[model samples]
Structures are given as structure tokens and as C-alpha cells.
Target: MSERTGWDRRLRVRADGKGLVGHAGVVLLRRCADQVGLTGALAAVLPVGVGHGWRERAAVVVQLAVAIALGAVNLSEAEQLALHHRNLFGPAASDSTTRRTLAALDESALTRMAKARRTVRRHVWSLLHLRPGGFPWLSVAGRRLKGWIVVDMDATVITAASKKERAAATF
Candidate 1:
């Protein structure tokens, strides 16, 4: 067998005006936001600070939600969007900015946000033709069970190859 382990270009390069191209999926999210009035609803419910721009509050909240949906465990992941799709998502908030924004939420703001989210959810469900169904039931062993749900949270097993804090042989 020949030993060749490097990537080879298959397509000719064409000079494009833009250098960045990724996270095109965010376009779908933007369209969905427009269709469901997500940003508008959020703007109506969220509090705007003195420095807030016309759409800053909605933009930040929507970006955070999108980041979470895209599997961001922390606010720093917002930087990925900033790097790749800044034009699509607008200016991405820094990790500290995101943390401070969320931390500033008060009880009344939380309640309003909840209401807005519910409203937006209903609108989107209707637009998507989603039917809210009751809890799934199960029939097993000649018995019928209603309102049954199951969750399995399997734990990870770690083996101690070296000694450290709280390190055990097996956990």
C-alpha cells in the first residue's frame, strides 16, 4: 500500500468576495424567527437598558436561544457564531455580556419572558401545523398505563489510572 496521508484539493479555487462561509443553518433559524415573531415577542417582553439599541434586546435573547439550541454549553460558544456567521446573526455578545444580561433578569422580567415564550411557541406550533398531544400511554402485559414516561440517566464510569482528588479505583 502506498503511504499518502494528506488532503488533496479536488475543486479549483474561485475568487469569491466573501471569505467566510459556515453556519448556513442559521438562515433557517432567522426565517423561522421572522415567521414566528420570536424577536418581536421577545422585544415586547424583555427589558431594555439605557444603552440598548432598537433591536439589541431581542437580538441578544434570540442569539442566546439559538446558541443553546445549537449545543453551546457556555456563552463563549457564541464566539463561534461571531467568527463564522457574524453577518447573519449580527454582532455576537461576549461571554461576559451574555452572562450579565441573563443575570440581570428579575422576577417580573422572568414572568414576562415566560409569557412571551409561550405565545411564540403557540404561534410557531400553529404555523408548523403541530398538534399538541396528550401524554403517551402504554399497553403491556395485558395492562394499560396512562400518563407514563420514562427517563434513563446513565452515569459515566471513570477508572483511576493515577491518584488525584476524589479519585477512586472505579466510579
Candidate 2:
């Protein structure tokens, strides 16, 4: 397998479906982070050696994020990214290392991290603006708003089983 920076191995699409890696789509997310400069921007804001020899704290954070996107609830579960797909994703930081990295983040570091994310977001939006459609528009109340994006941060709750006698079943 050929090695690539950011990605451990080059990925190819196959129609026959001879070999498939489960959860391989996470690679795309990692690639997106690398392409959009999220990885580098985060690394710039976060301190080096925070993971104690992991080298790239940004990668650890990104990996953890990817794992969470894949339904990982904790840091130990994030290790599955490397454990199962070592070829697609290179070495991953241990939970302890990840804990250290997170612990190293002070208020100032978090502020810097937020700033870095905003910077990368702006850069990505600028690139989108250069696209053929000239960025996407949001419509509200039949009015098209240019250069606007709406994000809905709503909370959702799901109950598996309730002990209450009068509880209704949720599908």
C-alpha cells in the first residue's frame, strides 16, 4: 500500500466489492479536515507535545471527532479508528494521551482554537464563493438571503425504556 500524507494508504473505488473496510468513510472526513486546513489550523493553535510524543495534537482531536461522528462515546472507543483500520488511518493516540491533550487546553488555548476554527471556516466559505454557483443561499420566509447559512442547534431526547407505568412507547 502506498503511503500518503494525512492518509496512511491511497484509497481506490472498486465495483466488484472484493475487499471492503467497515467505517472507511471516516477517511473522507479526515481528508476533508486536511484539505480544508482544519488539521493545520488546530495544530497551530494547540501546543505541541501535549499528547506526550504523539506529535500532532490536532490529529488526535480530529480522530476523536471522527470517532464521535461514528458513534463513539468515549476516548477509548476512538482508538477503534486505528485498531480496525490501521491501513487507512495511521497510528492513533491512546485515551491517556488524548486526555493529556485535552487537559492541556486552557481557556486561552480554547479561545485560540475557536479563532482558528473561525479562520478556517472563513477560508472555506471564500473558496465556496468562488464556485460556479457562487456559494449557497438560505431562504427564510420566501426571502433568499445571500451569504447566509442557518444552523439549527436543537436538543433531542430518546428514551430506550422507561420504568414509569404510564410511559408511552417511542419508536
- Return the top candidate by TM-score: 2
Clashes of each: 0, 0
- Give the top-scoring candidate (lDDT): 2
As a whole number from 0 to 100, the lDDT of residue 88 in candidate 2 is 64
Q: Kindly report which residue pairs in candidate 2 clash with one another.
A: none
Candidate 1 Cα outliers beyond 4 Å, as residue runs: 1-20, 52-55, 128-171
Cα TM-score per model: 0.58, 0.69
TM-score result, candidate 1: 0.58
The lDDT per prediction is 0.64, 0.77
Report the C-alpha lDDT of model 2 over 77-117, residue by residue, as the tens digit.
Answer: 88766566655666777888788888988999999989999
